[model samples]
Target: MKVNIVGAGVAGLSLAWQLVQQGVEVEMFERGTRVGEKACSWFAGGMLAPWCEAENAEPVVLEYGKESLAWWQNALGEGFVDAKGTLVFAQQRDKKELKRFARRTQAYEVVGHDVISSLEPDLASQYQEALFFKDEAHLDPRKALIRLTEVVQALGVKINFEQEIEPEDLLPEKVVDCRGYNAAKTVQSLRPVKGEMLLVKTNEISLSRPVRLLHPRIPLYVVPRDDQHFMIGATMIENGHGHQFSVRSMLELLGSAYALHSSFAEAEIIEMGVDLRPAFIDNLPRVERDNNIWRINGLYRHGYLLAPYMAKLAADSIFSDTHEIEKLADFKIKEDRV
Candidate 1:
């Protein structure tokens, strides 16, 4: 059996990886010149913290997101995923916010400044207490995308870059649409959620894991990368396609970073990026099958956290002789045409 995957984003690449492993021929078409260019996953924080995400997301997200952790580690091999876990903190004035977050999420241990310092010394003096999700992990989205692309290609999947193929154009050809926000026209329920991120480098501070600074307004998360660099993000503005970051957004993001640590104020700005993430009304991912064309979309901000599991469901549905929609009801499998 053979399949044509549209869009080489995390979702499409993940599907290609799974299908090829099952002895299926796979060909991928990406409009971007290379991987992670046109995809919203490029700007992701790459946190695999399902428990942390459960604060705002549904239970299904946490369930499948946990399963995807092993899938990513196995697919990328050793040393790619940082399994140090996630630290969530809030300001003293916003202590209620921390309580609220803890109330909504589970699988975390509340710790004081001593433990916080032990986990990330840079944060010892900044936060009095925090929630630690020990089972969580993170990876660099850019590195993961490039590595996954290489792995799939090595597995005999042909990837055609700079090639644009609409899902409808590949009708009756076993197409999997992972076009994200570009598929808004066909997937009417899909909406664009604009997310903005900034990359900064500072030698003054160090972090071992992703840290979330909870706020009533725009919550912030800073993921550590190699070379004293940190990815600061967390803006979920609704309905916009502009690629440039707004002044207010920049201020809030930077201010939140400063709140995390004073060193960020002097950190060198490495990059600023903005992109629209596709999301459904419930802000969860879905695997929708319409005849021979299957769509793996509505990943929202959970692209890296959920794509692997979503792709598994898509691959299973495709290879199954009988409809597996009922079996995957929790993943929100939709049989209606999109």
Candidate 2:
């Protein structure tokens, strides 16, 4: 059987990879010419910290997201998953925020300044305590998407670029829509959550792993890329695709980074971006069949963290022809018409 996947973001590419592995013929349609283009996955910090995310995310996120790190290693081959872990710290005055985060999360070790210094030397002098999630990992989202496109093609899957598709217009035996925020056009319950991110480069400071800087209003994370570059983000604004970056957000982000390390004050701003991430009212993913199309979306901010598992579930649903779908509430088994 053949499957036509819409949207070449993390979800689409991941599903395509999974289906191809299951010996299914796969063809993908993407509106953008290049991978990551027009997809919010491009702006992601690439953090695989399921435990830290548990501070606000549902328990289900922890279960599925934890599996993603291993899935990515298998998908991308060895050396792709960075297992340096995640470090979370807060200002001395706002240390209560750290306590609250620790209370909500698990699989973390609370470390004092000396241990924190050994783990992240730059942060040791500034913050006296931190929560370390040792099993967490990260990857470069842009690189992963590009490599996924190549891997799928190498596996005999075809990708059609700049091809905007409507599910009804396609004649494929099966269709899987992973269109992220654009899925809102058909899925009314899916809403857009605008997120803004920034890229900066500085040789003044170095961080081995992703670090979260906790603040009362603006919580920020800095994910290190190759060289002296870091991807810092993100502001979660409800609804609307305000594509332009806000001055207030920039101030808060930069101010927070500076608070984490004064060296960030001299860091050269590289790039700034804004994209709308799709989310349900409850901020979880769903798999549902509407006619011949299987819509999988509402990843929210957990794009990299959840794509692997979502793709596996989608592949299993198609292969086994199962009806009792898990995860989200709306998923239901329908008759086989494919």
Candidate 3:
């Protein structure tokens, strides 16, 4: 079988990888000049914390996320994933928020200062207690996307960058629309959620894993990257995307980072990114089919965590001869002719 995938973001790239591995001839088109240029996954925090995400997301998210964790490791190799797990904590005054998070999530161990210190010495002085989701993991999104592109290209998948063609334009060929927010016009139910993030470099502190700092109003997570770099994010603004970061978001993110560790006050601001994440009303992902076109989107903030599984589902439906597509989607859309 031959397939064409649009939008070379995490969703498209993952599907390309999956289809190519299945011996299907795959061709990908991207509007951007290159991978990660216009992709929201480029600015993602890349947390693979299914249990941590379970605090607010649906159970399906956790289930698929856990499967995605193993999929990523197996597909990309163990070295690609930083399996140090995730840490969630709160200030003394906001201890109730920690309790609330703990109540909603599972697969974690409550740890005191000693365990906290062992996991992240920099945070030991600031936080006395935390919930450790030891099975969780993280990765650098930009690196992961680049790696996926390389893997797919090596597997003989052809990618065309700077190409902007709608799924309808590729008629008669199986098409998977992983265009994300770009498909908002046709997928009327899709909405954009603005997310702002920051990249900071601080040599004073070191962290092995991602850490979530709980607050009543603004919850923040800091994921560690190589060479004392950290990805600090993100604000779930209901407004659409903007070219610049909002002052309020910056202050909240920086303040939250400072609260997590005082050294962040002196950290060099490496980059500030703002992008619109496509999400449905339920904030869960979906795989919808309209004749020959299949749309895989609505990953929200769980791009890296869920895109792999969504891509797998898309691949499965493309090759399957039965009505198993409905069973693979988080939300079922009646099959309709375009």
Candidate 4:
């Protein structure tokens, strides 16, 4: 069957790859110059730490997204990603919050200042304690997206560049829309959570995996990339689509960076960006079928962390009814699997 996908984001591209691998013909249409760029997954921290996410995410997020980091690394290969684990820290004042976080999550060990210092010399003595989720992992989202694009294109999938596709253009064969906020115009009540981010360059601090700093007012995360650069984010504003980072937001980000490690004070700010994460009030992704069109949206912040799992289920969605993936079904699902 020939399937035409409307968006080239992770959901669309990944679904395309999975379908074509199943001996189906696929074509992707992108309104932008390329794929993945339209979605926040492109700039994502790509951390698959369900434990860390448990700090704020719903219970289902941890249970479902836990299989993501390793699944993608194994399928996409090691060169396209990294599974180095994540370290979550906080100031002494936020120690109570950290304890609460640990109490709610699993698969982590407490790290004291000494062990934390040993792991991140640049962050030595910076934080009193941190929670280390060893089973969790992170990757370079930009590189991973590019690699996924290249691989899918090489697999006989045709991509039309800068082509705008309307709903009437969709066909009856398994079409999943992954257009992110663009779908907002189609799905009513869809809200955009504005996330502002900053990139700074400073080899003064090097981190192998993603790190999160718990703050009372604003929570922040720092994702290190190649060439001593780090993608720091973000201020979660409830309304608006302004791409420019506000003065106050930037100051808060930089201050958090400094609080995490003193070396970041000397880092040069490279880039600032803002985008809306399409979401419902619940913040969990929803897959809806309109006629033959399967619309997947509301990824919120889990686009990178959940896209692989989403794609796999999307594939199954095309061929069969999904297994719901609830934790209560775990035992029956596993037992019935073999």
Candidate 5:
């Protein structure tokens, strides 16, 4: 059966790849000229730390996110998913905040000043206590998106850029909408939560993995990219303002980076970005099959962490013709055999 997928974001691209791999012809449409710009995944820190996310996310996040590490490795190959783990720390005043975070999460080892020095030598002087989640990983979202797109295209899936497709425009065996926040018109439960991030470059300090600096307010996460670049983000505002970055947010994010290491104060600010993430009422992803269109969305902050598994589920339902897809909206949806 031929499939029509709208939106070339991580969810859409991942789903297209899954369908095509099962010998189904896939055609994808994106309103943007390229795959990376329009989607919220572009601004993501790409941290796959399910244990850390469990502090605020539901149990399902950890359940599916644990699978994403291997899934992404298979999709994008080695060097794509960085397994350097995640280091979470706090300032002297925010020690309680760190302890509170540790109590809520799992798969982490409490590290003192000496251990922190051994793990990330640059951070040891600043933080006396930290929690190290050794199994956590991260990726460069842009690179992953591009690599996945290349693989899907090589598999003979057709992706048309600058094409905004509507349900009525396609006559395919199945139509899947992975438009993220743009699907709000069709999915009433979808809401856009604005997230802001900063990209900075510095050569003075080196870090191999993602780091979360805990605070009572304005917590920050920094994910190290190739070379001297690092991505710092933590803000999640309710309103869907996508025009520009807020001054207050900029100050806080940069301040958190400085708090991580004094060298960040001199790091060059390469870019500031803001994007709206699609989320459902429960802040969990759902696959609702209505008539011929299947809407997969509400990824929230777990796009990279959950899209692969969601894609597998969508593909299984499409091929089996037994599952309604909508009935699988429950958080307890089992892992797809694929």
Candidate 6:
């Protein structure tokens, strides 16, 4: 069957790639000139730390996101994933939150100042204690999306760059909407959660995994990229995508870095971006059919974390002959997870 998809971000590309792999002729439409160019995933920290996300995410998020490790390892090649896990810390006064977080999560060893300093020598004397999620992992988001686009193209997908079309007309055998937050105005209950991020060049410090700095108001994290670069992010504000950064956000983000490691004081700021993550109020992903179209949105901050399984479910729905007659029922998309 011939399949067509909208959007060129990770979700759109992932969907197209999965369909193509199943021997379907897939064509994709992108209003943007390149893949993964303007999407939120481009600036994400790419931490596959499902356990750490347990602090704010649903249990299913971890269950679904854990599949990311093996999927990414297969997609990006072995040794591409940084399996050093996540380092979570709280202020000396907020030690109770740290203990609570540890209690709620799994696969971690409580580390004292000595072990913490030994793990990240640069963090010596900075944090008194930490909970290490030893089973987590992270990846390079920009590289991963680019590689995903390349993989799809190599698999014979016809990616129509700089092209935009409405699904109201010219429907193919199957239509999938991977437009992320843009679907909010169309779908019910899906809201856009604004996320702000920063990329900095730190010749002075090199940390091995992602570090989650606990803040009473604005929780933050730092994801290590290639070379001396690191992606420090994510201020989750309940607003729309406003490119302008708020002064309070900068202060909080920078302050979190300082608390994580003092060497960040000397790092040169590289890039700052803000985008809206499409998410439901429940913060879980959903797949539903509308007339002739299948909508897959509300990835929230879990795009890289959930797209593989989502795409597979979508592809299976499209190929299911029985579902062609019924929308949701035909969508037997059993969360047939990764």
Report lDDT per candidate: 0.90, 0.88, 0.89, 0.77, 0.87, 0.79
- Candidate 5's residue-wise lDDT over 1-338, tens digit each? 89999899989999988888789999899999997878888999999989999999877789889999998998888778989889998888888998899888999999899988888899887878889999999999999999999999999999999998785567445888989988888788788889999998999898988999888888999999988999999689985666588889999999888887899988998989899999988888887676677778999999998898889888888788745564323555444332
RMSD of 4: 3.5
Task: Tell me the spans in candidate 1 whose CA falls farther than 4 Å from its real position.
Answer: 321-338
* TM-score preference between candidates 2 and 6, better one: 2
Candidate 3 lDDT, 1-338, residue by residue in tens: 89999999999998998898899999999999999999998999999999999888877778789988887876676578999999998999999999999999999999999999888998898888999999999989898999889989999999999999999999888899999998998999988999999999999999999999999999999999988899999999885766679899999999999988899999999999999999998888888888789999998999998898888888888888434564434332422321
Superposed by TM-score, candidate 4 places the C-alpha of residue 201 at a distance from the truth, in angstroms, of 0.5
lDDT of 5: 0.87
Poorest 10 consecutive residues by lDDT, candidate 1: 329-338
Which residue segments of model 5 deviate by more than 4 Å?
Answer: 326-329, 332-338
RMSD each, Å: 3.4, 4.1, 3.7, 3.5, 2.8, 3.7
lDDT of 6 at 9: 83
**Most lDDT-accurate candidate:** 1
Model 6 poorest 10 in a row by lDDT: 323-332
lDDT per residue (tens digit) for residues 1-338 in model 1? 98999999999999999999899999999999999989998999999999999887877778789998899999999889999999999999999999999999999999998899899998898788999999999999999999999999999999999998788887767889999999999999999999999999999999999999999997999999999999999788999778989999999999999998898989999999999999998887888888898889999989998899888889988999335553333444432322
Residue 74's C-alpha lDDT in candidate 3?
Answer: 67
List the pairs of residues colliding in candidate 5: none
- Once model 3 is optimally superposed onto the true structure by TM-score, how far is the C-alpha of residue 128 displaced, in angstroms? 1.3
- Clash-forming residue pairs, model 6: 278-298, 323-330
Alpha carbon lDDT of residue 142, candidate 3?
Answer: 91
C-alpha TM-score for every candidate? 0.95, 0.95, 0.95, 0.91, 0.95, 0.91
Give stretches of model 4 more than 4 Å off: 172-174, 321-338
RMSD, candidate 2, Å? 4.1
Candidate 4: global Cα-lDDT?
0.77
